[model samples]
Target chain A: MPADLTRRKLIWGGLGAAAAAYAGALGYPVYRYLADPAEEAAELAKVTEMELPEEELPAAGSATILQFGARKAILIRHDDDTMVCFSAVCTHLGCTVAYQADQDRIYCACHGGVYDPRTGQNVSGPPPRPLEEFNVERLDGKVVIRRA
Target chain B: MWRGSMAKSSSAGLSALGARVWNWCDERLALSSIWAIAEKKTVPLHRHTFWYFWGGISLLLFIVQAITGVLLLIYYRPGPEAYDSVRSITYDIQFGWFVRSLHSWAANLMVFAVFVHMFSVAFMKAYRRPREFGWWTGLALMGLVLVFGFSGYLLPWDELSYFATAVGLEIPRSLPGVGALIANIVQGGPEVSTVTVQRFFALHVFVLPLVFMGILGVHLALIMKHGSAVPPSEEARPERERRSIPFFPNFATQDLVMWLICFNVLCVMAFVFPWQLGKPADPLASAPEGIHPEWYFMSQFQVLKVLGEWIPGYLGEILGIGLFTLGGVLWGLLPLYDNTSQSGVRARHATWLALIALIGLLALTIWGYAGL
Candidate 1:
């Protein structure tokens, strides 16, 4: 009986060890495959500053969305000629928020998220957080937006 | 006399050779035992016997889908060429439109049939005792079927499919923490680009089929092990009064006849109303009006939409998903909770739960369409 018990225990131990090894062997490859290579490169490309020419800026009282290091940023020039830049992605579900010139606010059509264009604050609807604001600089013939 | 004797001897010799070959295989494989098991298997005949046919109907449609899908794959290409390839199939290739239409129609019909089969099983209280695994496996299969439909929907790369898939991905993207990561992996990036098409194509054609086939094998094996569950009503009858037909030639024959009818219906739908290919998707273009998902997904879509409007600060969408998940868990675990009160009687609370769920699904689906 003692010998039989030892044999069974050895068998079970071997099986458990084999199972763990097998899981690690399979899981690592899957993890690597699901980790997007492009995402890593995008991370590496993130810089503190992006320069846009004044000619490239949209007409005053309107807005334009641009790519900033794998993320979307919106640039708006109010009627009074003050320039503001904020992340275009809604805090609610990552849907792109659009500047509504008529309402003088940013609106996310996905879930009706509303934000204050001037301050980039969550005003109403399902947005849980305020949009990330960026500092805008006016140089000679250049409009530079710097990440905050 | 000589010619007659020679012909008779030759025929006898052929029979003896055939019998020897059969015996050789039987000794190694025990084929006769399998035949015996089939001969002994039986299906109970009752008023609810008709409900039993829906499972077979779904299986038949799945088979049709497999064949038509393979036919489409012969000409279909994924990625940037996806839209063009499908366009060529629909407009240029011989009988390609029919194959695509059949696959689409079969997918829809199979989903409907599975739903009916599941509800019938629930109402009939077929998910009791030893057959609990059958119910669970069936639910898993249904979930796989939905995934199959969703993934396949995006393969065509048309305007409707692209935008609908984009909207559908919102459900997962709305999730907290790993939501962005999951969405990135699923869509192959931050957006539903050509890469998304390739990923979905792989999922639809290869990954999903492999998993689906494995689960389906288990489900069928379980059905064979337990036979068909006689409804509670049928079970209440005296054993002497109960009637059952052998599965081999009897129940199988009925199943085949139902499949034939289903095939005819599929053919008519595929031929009469061919599936349409819309304009190619433009990522920058605004979503067209009345954009909604497939009918199977309409309920959840409507729930999210209504709740998103009513609640504030992401709480409403969260609540909507939470409630839906809770309901699904309860439904999937029905066999575990509703196992008691056996002996050929319907469980009252379980029935009521199922009825409410059914009514809610129907109402929500209708509301989704109406609002659209």
Candidate 2:
């Protein structure tokens, strides 16, 4: 009877040791994810309600970079003097492609991927699709991207 | 004579049905003793050194990762849409967070175990002689696994992933002529884009898994062919006359026990901390304060600092990258390196120490990444 109890105890002990070693191995990545930045953004994006503004248009020949809500936007004045909004995320790896005024094209420094500012087309490089476009309207002088 | 021939034909007919029809011939059939075969194949009764347990433990971790990783995939979204999907998973699914964390942790353990196993194999000069290919195979698998880690690191679409990937892409950019080209392909054009996440997600969850599985299959098959090394003992045989258990029932039972224990630990981790979803990767937002490579690559990250992007020109850089690869190939073809006999306990111990030192240095490089 004593031997049987000892054997049972041994089996459970072995089981416990194995479980602990396995958990110990997983320490680092868990620490990394807990401290990630994305969690912060999720907190920031939550809104009860936000009243967007109205403004006079910046002009037809140039573009403006906007950070509204959690999204980045490139608001361009088209040939018609109307504002068009598009997500600044490069159609490629999701890098924020910036408008280079000198070149009149959006360029991603990460991989040298370039896209057309007007059409959001992949002019040169590895973009599988064009930049995602969003509709914008001028209520007064201010511009609001239709998120809803 | 006619009656005996008829009897043999009838038995052959029974075997044709695929059931154990031969059992009916029990009366006259020549019965070879399967028990005798088992006896001949049995491992000698001997206990393994504790170090020997490391490889079994590593195998245990690998199996754990496979199970956990598969479960995590059901909730993982590997595209521009990854962040939202992961959120929904945490809130909507029962035990979603638990599963994800378990998967994440299991992957971490697997990488740790594989490295430990790898170093063990190297030190014991277990890669020597007929098993050199086995050694090389393990090494190549190690490379594939790191790639697995790097690619998967970006899948969660969190801020850390965003920054880590930005750093990760720079390694290829340091390559030379093809560096830019490779970086573009990896990024799915330019910058950290959704496709980059998608591509890495595919590689992490699908492609690398396939390749790793293939190499692993080959690795175990070769280990079986070559046999495992028995650790050095006070009552030891000369290396030349050393023998091993046939790697089946002898080691398999322990592997099972190790796996069960590892799984239980993983469960505890899942419940305690759960997998935390990071801030959604926002391109416009700058990276958080301090960013580091995933643990498995910490050593290599340290190397990059010391080595400082020394790929030379495009060709030279390619060569630099190729050197380790070349070493792997050379290591794999061990049977060819010296088919000659290496006999003695001293030689075995020396080989073991050499392999351990090499692996230890590599791990140190990772450990020192922060310093660099």
Candidate 3:
């Protein structure tokens, strides 16, 4: 009886090991295939700087969204002659936030989330964090925006 | 003495050797048990017996698709060269057009067959009690088949394919907060491009087929375990009056005949109306007039369009999507609603619901085409 029990255990254990090996053999290639190829990440990382034509920049107290390496960034020229730039994506849900000149704040129309236009800080609503800030400068009459 | 002499004869020696080999394999494999199971299996016969052929027909069409799809993949590239490769296949390669047309036709036929089979099963109350899981797995298979159609529709990369995909993405894009994000991830960017094509290719060729086969295996196993369902009407009859034929030879033979008929129809369609390819997609050009998705999606497309116009904002789009999703969920939950109550009042409600849903789909589809 002991000999028969040992034989059964050996066979079952061998079968279980084979099944796991089979699963791994099929899984590894599928994982490699489905995973992000990182090419898009590389492209996004490649663009550390974006330049917008100075003429295209919005007037004081207004803002315009700029294409910044697979994302949208807002460039605002305040009434006080101070300029600030931040990602337009809402902190709560990825909706693009727009500057509301009347309220002097950036507003996510999607969920009514509000952010401080000058400091890029979430002020109210569903937003849990501040919008990412970008470095902005005037270079050769172009509004140059760089990752900060 | 006569038996011993016969066993020593030359022909008897060959027969003995064959029997020995069969016995040797049977001792290890137990093959006869499988044969016994097949012999014992039977299919129910009734006025609705014709519907049973449809599920088998869908399987037959899927086999055709698998073969022709593999053949097309040999030359069809999925990225920027997609259009050119398809163009070459249509005009350059020998018999390529035929194979492509066959695959396309088979896909459409398979979807049609699966739908018919599902509705027939619903009306038959085949989802009762023990067979509930079979219905669920079958629904999953149908969903996979629809995705297969959606993904394959975009592979040609023509103007129609490109515009259709863009419009189709709008369904997912209209969802509230992360709608656009979901759409972006699916298309691999803000718009349908080469990356979208590659993503769809991988899905259509690899991921979908693997998942489909897995689900299909379970579905067939469930069918084998439970056997063919008798319609509620037939089940009302006396048990002694009920009749069925063995699955091994009689029903299997009937299934083969149905497959042949299906093949004949498929060939006629493929040859009579070969699939066409429009001009390659131009991303910069304004979308041409009458941009629409495939016929299967027309109902939902029209719903969104009409509803969007009526409500005139995000609210309308959300309402349309919400209603459609609710209908789908209810449809998937039919088995849960009517389990073990084939003759109850709930069964009548289920039947009426199926009828209304079917008519609604047909009407919406027709309305969509007319508006187009």
Candidate 4:
């Protein structure tokens, strides 16, 4: 090859190599990012069970707050023989729902949303879905609450 | 032995077939004439030649947005299911996050490139005489791009986008006569709802793209017809002093190299700080604290906020909207307003006015970033 042709080829080759290296440097991380899926299910699957004394459990027509994992849940003793649990977070706007003993339903203060304690169904207002229900069990002398 | 020879013969036959097909098409279409035109094109070479690359860079980013956007459309759903579908695409679908993030980032980068191209053209006075229509088309494209960003913002149906869009739609309400009507048409109802989301999705994916492509086609045709603009300084110089480099290899190679660099930067941004989907929107809930529009709209947001505080009520909104509209109109009609000849040596007063407007916008953007 001519001397000038060799010099031009060397310069172009060097620039192309540099560009390839830069692409690899940037692309490797993006490859990893696209490859890995966010593990939201695994994070939410962590279960926490808490046991409360029988006397501490709310009586019929009343409810008490309980902690499960990172969420707040309402545990209600619907009747002498029945107990139920529902997430305190409202289905409408995610505000904490308050147990209304007088109204006989759970109430969200942000909006006038109401839910049935027995079924966790949105009976009135703007809520579109029922409050998420959690598993509740009575064993021996204590009431156990498990997050769903 | 027969299988190997047959395979070799088939490959050779395919090459012959491809050549014959090319010749048949070339005979009717006269493809060589197109090649001759490309070969004859030349780009001006001067100190301000670097500015020319900005247009090409903007075009490159637009192409990137188109590709990535189509990829995203395969998985994206509009309306009530929009938020969840976006989440699923990002977290569950294979390589969906990368494609979505690339689309989002490229949209932002394209806007940035367009702004730079606009300013460079302004400072260089490339919008003179024959290029006046080209300038108008460019301004129209910029408006269309901003609309694209606004429409795309609501597609995810997240809290930030929800409130930001509410504020965005409210701006048009300050117009005197048909403000509310225009706002209603843009939003598809009295308020932002499923219908609004559907309309915005249509605008972002179908309506805006079609309009943008049409304007872009005209703008590109204008550019090619007129060739690249001569810088004001170069234009003032003697004809013998002017110089140019061939567009085929010299200018095109530089554009390609810049595009490669920009691609690397885009990949790094999409990977390192991928766009986030904020909390799902709840219409019943009040707008969240510190809610703001995208960065590109920050200046207008700050303007409205400050003016509203000072004037108190609809008056402030009208004044701010009026001022912003006036600025936009002035920018669009700049060539007509300032009739400096193409080969003039002295700078026009309009150039100073443009510089001041640019500085004012930059200051407002900074103030918005400071969250004041």
TM-score of each: 0.69, 0.58, 0.69, 0.70
lDDT of 2 by residue, B1-372 (tens): 656765889776555544455555543564445434433442323354445666667666667667667766765777878888778666655555765777678778778777777766555556656676787777778788778778877888889988899888977886757888999899898788788999888778778878888988898777655556544352266555645564357656755666677677767877787778888899899767667777766755555544555543445545544554565564455445434345465555456545655676577664676474
* Consecutive 10-residue window with the lowest summed lDDT within model 1 chain B: B340-349
Model 1: CAPRI class: incorrect
Error of 1 at B350 (Å): 0.4
lDDT of 1 at B368: 94
Chain B TM-scores of the candidates: 0.95, 0.75, 0.95, 0.93
> Measured against the native two-chain assembly using Cα atoms, what DockQ does each of the candidate structures obtain, in the order listed?
0.01, 0.03, 0.01, 0.06
Give residue B349's lDDT in candidate 1 (0 to 100): 77
Q: What is the lDDT of residue B30 in candidate 2?
A: 41
User: Is 3 or 4 the stronger prediction by lDDT?
Assistant: 3
Give the per-residue Cα lDDT of candidate 2 at B66: 76
Between candidates 1 and 4, name the one with more favorable DockQ.
4
Tell me what TM-score chain B of candidate 2 gets against the true chain B.
Answer: 0.75
Q: How close is candidate 4 to the true structure, as a TM-score?
A: 0.70
**Model 1, runs deviating above 4 Å:** A1-148, B1-6, B9-17, B341-346
Could you give candidate 1's per-residue lDDT for residues B143-258 as a string of tens digits? 99999999999999999999988988877888899887999999999999999999999999999999999999999999989988887777778899999888889989899889
List the pairs of residues colliding in candidate 4: none
Q: Give candidate 2's fnat, 2 decimals.
A: 0.00
User: Could you say which candidate leads in TM-score?
Assistant: 4
Give the candidate number with the greatest DockQ.
Answer: 4
Q: What is the interface RMSD of each candidate, in Å?
A: 16.1, 7.3, 13.4, 4.0
Chain A TM-score across all models, in listed order: 0.83, 0.61, 0.75, 0.66
Q: Report lDDT (Cα) of residue A55, candidate 3.
A: 87
